[model samples]
Target chain A: VARPRIEQAQQHLDSLTKPPGSLGRLEEVAARIAAMHPEGKPQIRKRGVFLFAADHGVVVEQVSAYPQEVTAQMVLNFLQGGAAINVLARHAGAEVTVIDMGVNHNFDRQLPLLHKKITKGTGNLRRGPAMTREQAEAALTVGVELATQAQRDGIDLIGTGDMGIGNTTASAAILSVLSGHAPEAITGHGTGIDAATRRHKVAVIEDALRLHQLDPTDPIDVLAKVGGFEIAGIAGLILGAAAQALPVVIDGVVSIAAATVAYQLKPDVVDYLFASHNSTEPACRAGFQILGQEPLLDLQMRLGEGTGAILAMNLIEAAVKIYSEMATFDTAGVSRKQLP
Target chain B: VARPRIEQAQQHLDSLTKPPGSLGRLEEVAARIAAMHPEGKPQIRKRGVFLFAADHGVVVEQVSAYPQEVTAQMVLNFLQGGAAINVLARHAGAEVTVIDMGVNHNFDRQLPLLHKKITKGTGNLRRGPAMTREQAEAALTVGVELATQAQRDGIDLIGTGDMGIGNTTASAAILSVLSGHAPEAITGHGTGIDAATRRHKVAVIEDALRLHQLDPTDPIDVLAKVGGFEIAGIAGLILGAAAQALPVVIDGVVSIAAATVAYQLKPDVVDYLFASHNSTEPACRAGFQILGQEPLLDLQMRLGEGTGAILAMNLIEAAVKIYSEMATFDTAGVSRKQLP
Candidate 1:
């Protein structure tokens, strides 16, 4: 962050028609964006949401409400612009890109899909590590490559999303290892599972955590042992955006797990990332605590398809507009506050 | 609220690609809008924000940080599209209308103004009632009349905002009576007051509340005793919107004070109210508790110029689009969750 530009932005915010420091977080958002683009006008016109679609082998344990096939089907729905993500992205004036990372299904050749498959799917984590260390690294590499491509294609803002069934199990397991919280303490009913299914899911995650004995210090170890392929991809996206000095907004629990990994790798990446919301997932709250990034919105959304991320685009744009357009008290001939 | 249409909206939400209720409050918003329209499509194309500008004679008590004249100046700033509300309303695709309810200063005839002045300004509450019962009624009538005009002119949504110096003290006084909280517990550093000034502001509210001994059941008596002109206007706007069955998005503390009064008038008006964000004001939080309404956003914003209300228009529009668009499970051939 550029200190001079941030100071300048704060000065500008103070001079607005309203009382000084009255705009609250909106002013902070403006200051941060000003620091991001020191030239001052940090407009977010070309926004893109990278939807990483994959399937988790852990669903074989019946941990999720929906079937694994729903992941691939939703990917297709996203391509056809029939999903919640598609609706929200369109509303936010952002383009959506569906990345087929490891869906365990084939897509039509004519569809606008980014083929970055690390594998068909990872091994079931209830027994052992979900994927080898090499495969985890490869998935993260793909995310970085996709983010680089977006930045090269004139995308100013990137939003991270996932479409993997039973991925919340993986996210919870990873968080349990990283935060040292019990599986039941961090687990939530992903996709609205029943009581028995939730208990079963918790038992599966506890088994996975014990079986892998993952290293808390090493995020890659955590990802290979418990995280899903799309989670690794999202981690890479955050790292790539940070390296390129681009802002990346992350969605829900899955995205938070990825952000945790990215933050572990490079603490500076936290500056480049924006948490879209504090999801209903109990583990997501733990992940945010570990990262110390407050979400901009909290609608209790648990659909991790960049829906929350895209909704925040409006707020980000409003902050930029207020920073760039609103006249100062001096310019507008408005009187300033009288201090006693 | 239409039951059949709300049921239909819920069915549509369930049939979407994501899990049922994964959209959370967004789904609830869609159902409410569906109930409002009931015929199927609920659109919010035309949005209007009514900024009621006025002045408070209580500023003579030195309870505010800014001079009272800034109220009229901000009214001009709003008209010139140079205020924070103007910037945010433009960003949210909403039109801004500045109504001169009781600003102490005069405006140029060339300027576009509602010119609905009830009085020059309210009497200092520390001395006596802010306004006569008749003036309080008239100011509220202005709000209803303005809302009716907006609805007739094709505004599908109404957002209420207020700009009046020392209004926060008045708001705290109103809430202190309604919520039965002590003055210090409800008062805050409105517009960034110093430590001594904040103490003085609380003392002023305490005196006003004790002097009036206002009846909580009679909202009109409370407003007449301590509320500013713009606050009454906003109360009237909420009543008018409810009478017309129009959705009214309300801004921060000042707006909530108005809402408290309006709710007291007609409890059914709560059905039409959408809280934009929870303000940082301690009294605003208590006001929301009294109204039993949870805000959609909480940005810690203290600038009460309909900025938060305008920002909420984006979320409302997104909900409508998601309800009206997005292929259902049957239409898109997606599978639903299997409940045990």
Candidate 2:
């Protein structure tokens, strides 16, 4: 973030009507937007969310509660505008883009898919790496290119989303490696698994981390060893947004894990990112801790269709509006308190 | 709240596409709306918020950061649609009604004020009781009658807000009396007071509580002894809404103090309340703990012009819409997971 712009924003906010620092986090949000673009009034007039839909080979471990086909089905659901993200994005006045990163199914040739599939799906991480290092880099490049595309298309703010069944196992494995926490400690019942399935998922993640023995400092190695293709894509998106100086709102655990990888790659990405929710997933908290970012909201929502991103977009818009529109104490003729 | 409708609402929510209880507090919000209606659908199409602007003689004790004139000035700001509440209420699709419970200044007769001023302001609680028992009961009756009028005007939901200079001092006093906490423990800087002013505010509250020596269980006695008119009005609004089965969203610490008093008067009023934020005020948390309520959001907001209530109205509307409009698993043809 630009420190000069942030200081300017704070000074501006302190002069607004009502008490100094009274608007709380909303004031911080306005300052963040100002830091992102210091020259003129910053606004989120055009919003775009990239929903990276892929299949996780880890599903073969029976770690998730739902079938893998739900991933492709949800992608179609997105195109048909029937998913939660579509509803919430519309509510937030944002557009949704579905990127076919590594789904196992083929779509119609005419469908509006970003079509950057690195592979049909990632390899089963329990026995081997989820993907080749080259594939991970390619997925990350896809994210970078998509973010550039969004900015070129006049998208002011970007949001990260994921739609892949059993991807939580991959996310947990990545988090366990990065956060140095035991797999059981960072694991949660993703998509509402039963106790037995949750334990099995934990074991799968534990086994993957033990087998991979990847270096934590190298984000690409982590992504190739245990991360999903969509996760790498999300990381790429974060880097792309940071390079272009656009604010990106991150969704839940999977997205935060991606952001963790992105932050490791380019620490400046942290300045351009806004976290969405403290998801019910335990791993998400660990990932956020690693990134040193606090989520703007915590609704206990685990339905990660970028719903949290959309809800946060509303607040971001409000922050920008308040910063731009609210009359200052001088303009409103509101008297300041006399301190003793 | 209607128990039968709450049961039916849970049944309906279980049939949704997401995991059971995945939405967390949002589901509880939907359930509350269902219980309020207990019929085909519960919707808050017409939302109303009452902003009770009053003055407190306790300002003579140097207990507030802002001057007493701000109470009436903010009321005029509300009437002119130039305050935070106005912006937020428009964003939430809610209407605002400024009720002059006891503003020190008089407004133009044609300025659309709910003019029910109770003696221009309350007496200094440091010297004696804030108001007589008859005046406390009268102010509460005004709240009851206003709620009835709102329901008659087709307002589906109600929100509580306050605009008083030293109302937080009065609110802290009420909370200190009722929760058995020391004044220093409950008192916080209202409107961003300096350290010395905050300390003095706490001392004034302590002196008032000792002077009153009122009964904690008797809410009316507590209000008559230490509460401001707007606090009593909020309590009365909550009770009236509960009697009519309307869900009322509360703003912050002052509203929580009012809700605490209402909860004491009729414990079932808890069922009809939707808390807005986990205010930064320590007394607000104590008040919520007393009422067994959790706020829906925590934005660190301390501004008390119904801004929090308006933001909460947006979520309440979303909850109602999701409950009534979102497709169920059976309707959406989404398969449920087979649990072991």
Candidate 3:
């Protein structure tokens, strides 16, 4: 039902005054929304970027080269508008909100912290499940609450990104379980880890799968057992965005893993998920292919501080504008060129 | 001399209030400019993007699947705000001026076209020289005039981009001749050409090299014989921008080839050039390495039409803001953290 409508909108938009397919992926997105609500224009006035920050217990395994403290430092950097994501978001005119999902540090309650700590961080997944079923649910609930608040604020477009050191290992574990791929196939040398460290990271994910008796076919169970708090929260955000009819620009491999979980939980949620870019991670291409989503950008970028999503914000805006403003050929008094 | 000044500026900027080397290449750019001026803060204002359009005679060899007619069609696309470069330049708030360096069509004399056509197009480079030395000089002179006008209009920053369907082939030929690399090493499948077509394109360039008796060491001679008019114009634009002390964001392979020629002609002119992105073109890396410049971005982008340069405009703004803003640590009354 959703696919037909989106496709119809795309067809309508393509037939507008400009050259067919000249707007590139922007045309695709605009058409998708037109299909979503065939009777009215799809507006993206209140855009919100939800940045979920947490601590990956895999940092305890010494897999990441950077100290775990860099995660908190980067959060402060984001607040101060010094990070690349901040610069990109500012350029796109997107409102960014940071969530301290389960970071180890404590901040003043009045400092706008969401305060949804899920066990202060997951235990190192090399030994066991990152979070129990109850904690994962709590994290998802937090995501739901965030999305609900965004909807109340009239946010029509929701983009999900994350900041968690060593979370790539968590993403690989979740992806392996969700996509039915082996750990080695989905795992990558995240954040410039050496080959030995990457191999060790893969082994840790494998150990976690065996310890949890994870079922690759069941995404929710996989997320509950192996997903980081931020990953679960992003999944919730995707589901919530879909429930509210808001589009979600899922960023990179980690976000795709979250989207997979969200789609598994609610199959219709795929309508709201727009994969932002084909990340450098090999698993990301497979993930998008399985989900039947095409990314707007194909830069070999793997720096997952929501950089790719922020860049895609401009493309999304262009799509919405074309949908709203582009006059049809008849209205613009332009004749279509006859096909040769 | 430019290299040392840029290095000095980078060092001074690294000592600013924020974390050392945290702002990445933006800081480096600002610092480079600061070192060049020494007395006053480096400023970037009144930015202009010169979109040089031409038709390559090499298109006669079927080097590009897109017909030569697409060149003029895209020029109209640029004027009508339907091209990717137009959208991106609009987003960056930079003014664009289109120049018909050597289009195969004639227009009203009263139109704003710069009558710089060396020929209807280059001579089919597969057979002989693309342009005579006199024609190449005339094209370069046109670029110089355009830059001079931009400077008079108070533009402190200029960017070079090109629009010609078969220009990538020309860029590859120029780069191979200048860098002494085999054509196959520098040539790529431009605009989705098939492997067989790509090989043919490379062989055509190799044939051109043999027919012209081109010396790999003489860059200007190579460019004069094998480069498109737009490339010659861009070489002049780089030199013109340097003469005025204005920074120019050099686009991908074609623009880099132009800059290489300009540098060979006037070694000191390299001061004004900044590599926008290391394009997916294999020759681009060698070009940048030869110029001793690092690109601001490396997203594997091969789409010319100034998309990469426009994308980098935001980073330049960030760098300039950091150079001009951001209270020093002493002024902010914040103690600097001791290095670990």
Q: Which scores higher on lDDT, 2 or 3?
A: 2
- Structural similarity to truth (TM-score) of each candidate: 0.98, 0.96, 0.76
Candidate 1, residues B1-340, lDDT tens digits: the string is 6677778878877877778889888998888887898765888879999999888989999998888888888888888888898888878888898899999987886788889888889999999999999999999999999889988999998999999998999999999899999988989988888889989999899888878888999999999999999999999999999999999999999999999999999998888888889888899888889888889998888898898898887898898888888888877778888755
Q: Order the candidate numbers by TM-score, best to worst.
A: 1, 2, 3
How good is the docking of model 1, by CAPRI class?
A: medium
Q: Rank the candidates by lDDT, best first.
A: 1, 2, 3
Best prediction by lDDT: 1
How many times do residue backbones clash in model 1? 0
Worst 10 residues of 3 chain B by lDDT: B331-340
- Candidate 2 per-residue lDDT over residues A1-340, each given as its tens digit: 8688898999988887778888888889889897777778887779998999889898988998888877887787778776677766765678999999999988886888788888889999998999999999999999999888888999998989998998888888888888899999989988899899899988888788879887989989999989999999999999999989889999998998899899888888888888988889999889888888888788888888787887787777777777776767776667778654
Instruction: Please give the distance, in angstroms, between residue A315's alpha carbon in candidate 2 and its true position after superposition.
Output: 1.7
Please report the candidate that would top TM-score against the real structure: 1
Among the numbered candidates, top DockQ falls to: 1
Residue A107, candidate 3: alpha-carbon lDDT: 58
Q: Clashes per prediction?
A: 0, 0, 4
